[model samples]
Target chain A: MNTESYLDSIRRGLRGAMESDERVYLIGEDLLDPYGGAFKVSKGLSTEFPKRVLTTPISESAITGLATGMAIRGLRPVVEIMFGDFLTLCTDQLVNSATKFPLMYRDKVRVPLVLRTPMGGGRGYGPTHSQSIEKMFLGVPGLTVVSPSLAHDPGTLLKRTILESERPVLWVEYKSLYPKQLLNGGDELRIWQVEGEDGYPLAVVENFSGSDPDVVVIAYGGASVPLFESMRRLIPEEIRVRGLLPSRLDTRTKTPWWFSEITGREPIIVAEHGTRGFTWGSEIAAELNLTFFGRLVAPVRRLADADNVVPAGRGLEREVLLNEEQLIKAIVESIT
Target chain B: MILIRYVEQSLLRLYAQGLMGGTVHTCIGQEGCAVGVVSAIDRQRDMLFSNHRGHGHYLAYCGDIHGLIAEIMGLPIGVCGGMGGSQHIQRENFYTNGIQGAGVPIAVGMGLAERFKGTGAVSLAFLGDGTFGEGAVYEAMNLAALWSAPTLFVVEHNGYAQSTPSSLQHAGDLSRRAEPFGIPVTRTEGADVIAVFEVANRLLGQIRAGKGPRLLFLDTHRFAPHSKGDDFRDREELERINRECDPIQRLAAQIGADTYEQVRKAAEIEVDIVLQELGVQ
Candidate 1:
């Protein structure tokens, strides 16, 4: 199973979404024919739900404002920001309008809206393109953030997100996760499932495998793959290690509770795809109560994009970047 | 209504006696402008956005005088639930906003929302002649016309924006300013409440009927100071204008008050009763 890719899984996820309700519709720029989107996941969506799907002008602010009004009037709209950097341009709609609506109206209204954007760093997609700005919205109380690292996980997480939550959801999908490998013998699609409250497996977390270990690494989005690959590279015997892809940021999932239960404390190394500032790294740390000793081995450390927005050249990129070796050194230093 | 002017005058008295906190932009002279427009507007189907000089607008729109008083007094029961002060009065259906041009965009957004909802509800934004120069007003006008938004832009031309007269501050004419945007414009005599009502109702009808946007410049007199503490005593024919421009006096004439004394005392009784309820002595 190429669990890394999200193409087939997302297709199945949309099918589940469409079958469950008629009100859920996708609307955004460059989503129509001749150009499915910056990525092709929405390529065939216009065909199946032609009337329901919409391709709009490049007005992010007005589009978000329109969606806010529509959501208030009982329409579930999913807006795809062409790039994560453009989310800043829609602050009037996002920060003040949508975030404050339910609280302002005292919960009489629910803005069942979703903003899905792509956040990836490997493609060297320069300054305007590669930032995991989803973390920037962590402090906002009314919004939920979901960062999925794999293709099928994306679809399943999206399906569960739409079905759940009374507030707005911000789903950040990594561009690298698209067109991932096929699962279930290359014909049938699958969703990695996690056990729900009723002891039945739910679509929140698809799979889990780790030995009894003292410390764990919790990561999300495209960065998760590299962390997983590094784990495989550093097979230190008997040290015990586990990994996490945070299914939902706004709501506490099994990750934090189980980790807190397992360690009798907070064991979190939250890695993100962008600059540490205006991001959720500190929020996660604060919530988990982990001391951020950044010397690669003291307390919990965060690996995010460097503060200065540098060019996407390989030399400058690798200098400020962290991969397998850095993770290992950090883990070894902590354990010792 | 006759009570609206009494409300403004009572508020001015409280402000002068140091019984109220914060400042009030008295609409003492422009009460007819608001009465003229809101009298013809459907309370349920139409909405009005007011300016800093919004007492007239609030009273004409049936905004609670207690809430207005509470607002000026910095009490929690103020129109914005006390979050907004005297300038930011907001009742159930009607509301005020921050700054000069902020309300215009919000009112424009409301009109847009109304359009999609198919309510046939017209939104009227009241601005002083000084506000005619605001960029948001122009932006609102352009969007309103482009969307054919059912909104009314009421410019209460009281001849002055604070101390500066419109003749010095505002360039061009109000009607001609609205003309380039294809907005139908009209001028109504603000001193004559009946004439004000006639123009207001006709324009409001077109708005509700979905016949585009209209701009009405109600040429009126400013009898009081721009604010609670400003000096605005008119020396040239001041007595005639104040005696003639009183909306309550004009309306009372039709009701046979016998003398201005009877009407004034009757209004004063109601004002005292209202002030008592507002926790004022």
Candidate 2:
């Protein structure tokens, strides 16, 4: 019965990292006491470690550069870029300087810099505030992009990103999932190897009712919410369904062997948080098609947000973002 | 001044002969600012961040002529393993970047780190007049002053930001912009190495003493174009300014003719040996 909210998990993880390592510290705008952070994930941390939590000016470019300089000088700096959209302002430092130093220096120096930001839509923050543009930085080498899904605890992943990672890591947190508590929370969120029991870092839950599954659903981050809910309502009494969740998107560490585990006539459905074209879901679908080419099944279908700006109103937002209805439709259509 | 002048002049010759890759921003008339500020600091303890026209700063701080030449020539044994050209060279405690006003805030971060670790070290960011127009510079200065971070921001005001003059790029006085942030500001006329050094030494001492951040605006002029293939300066005006404020000539005049010749000869021989060792023709 051990349960923790996603936001609380991140706070605990940050506190743990800062407490354990003297070199680890947090730097961002409005990260001090009283105003923990924009999302309040850094709540109470400033009070605990007064000297460690640094409140900075509204300069994402310099914030990133400062983190890079500190990392090179042997300090682990975790920079919080208030919103994911402002990550554009930090591209120069992130791409040219932070990502290049360790490799360019031939490992003589290490840039253990972590940039955490709130991404994804559903809160009606409009175009500038809400975004899931992790796909844009997918091609950047020497940078690791990780997303925490409902299946995995955010705290465990964040702690690993801070203490274990040797390169630059962009930890993307979804705003919608912040309030929800982990369903089956326990020690199940421990740091497992990439090639661990599941063959991936994803914390998957198999909810098959019958013997064989009619279709397999794969999703990540906030998008997995509707996928899980739709799978519950859409699966007929005769038909069975399986679910796969991925916490990390970069795939730089290890490739998921999910394709080999699920076979036969079961169709594959991939869902993602960002736009439909050239997204993380598409990447998974391509990998599935390549590995399971001879398997007898329908084409892998992908469900994602519409290719337009996330509108402000709730009705328009629902129309654009993936809903339970769309997931159910995709799941039902995949088997047919 | 002699070392920077020799490296820049030799690099200029190599650049003209097409032995170097990419654009080179030579600090021909602004050697005084680089040499002066670098000489005033404890190079082993203090960290430096440089902009595009950073060969002078690199030589003045690290004194690795062979490594710099190798990096410019794109050799395998370069400072950044030949990955970074002239614009980006990192070694020891010295780091350089080609982007404008990007490393200023980073210097502030290092300053914060130094204070946190109680290392008694200061971080210096070397920029050009071009960077004064950047919003990040003001942001960095504000943060540095607010947190009392030990950082020195040096603006080598050689008049032009690329081809555009400072009047076209910046408004009001540069030092006044920082005074509002409660950061101490210093404006010294460049071309006198000793003068730049004295002011830099004083400011660095204050910063090391935890007196917040300081800005030093060293006024000088560029003898060469901003970068490769950008000739837009008035030739007569340039000739007049170069004659009046040639830092090398100014320093040589102060040191006597015999010592000046010996220093120039030594610089040329040292550069020749470095270039020869790098197998650069």
Best by DockQ: 2
Q: Write the per-residue lDDT of candidate 1 for residues B1-281, one digit (tens) a residue.
A: 55667787778888878987777788776777888888888888676778788887887788467767777777766655555566765554465543565456446556655665787877788888888766657766766677677888888887778888788987677657888989998987786788889988888888888888899988777788878766655667567778877665676676675766676787678777878887675
Candidate 2 clashes between residue pairs 3 or more apart in a chain or in different chains: none
Error of 2 at A54 (Å): 2.0
TM-score of chain B of 1: 0.91
Give the per-residue lDDT of model 1 (tens digit) for A77-172: 677888877887665567765665565431245677888887766667777776667766765768777776642256766776665545677777
Going through the candidates in order, what is the number of backbone clashes in each? 7, 0
What are the lDDT figures for the candidates, one per model? 0.66, 0.82
Please report, as a residue range, the 10-residue window in candidate 1 chain A with the lowest summed lDDT: A198-207
Best by lDDT: 2
Error of 1 at A83 (Å): 3.5
Docking band of candidate 2: medium
lDDT, residue A331, candidate 1: 57
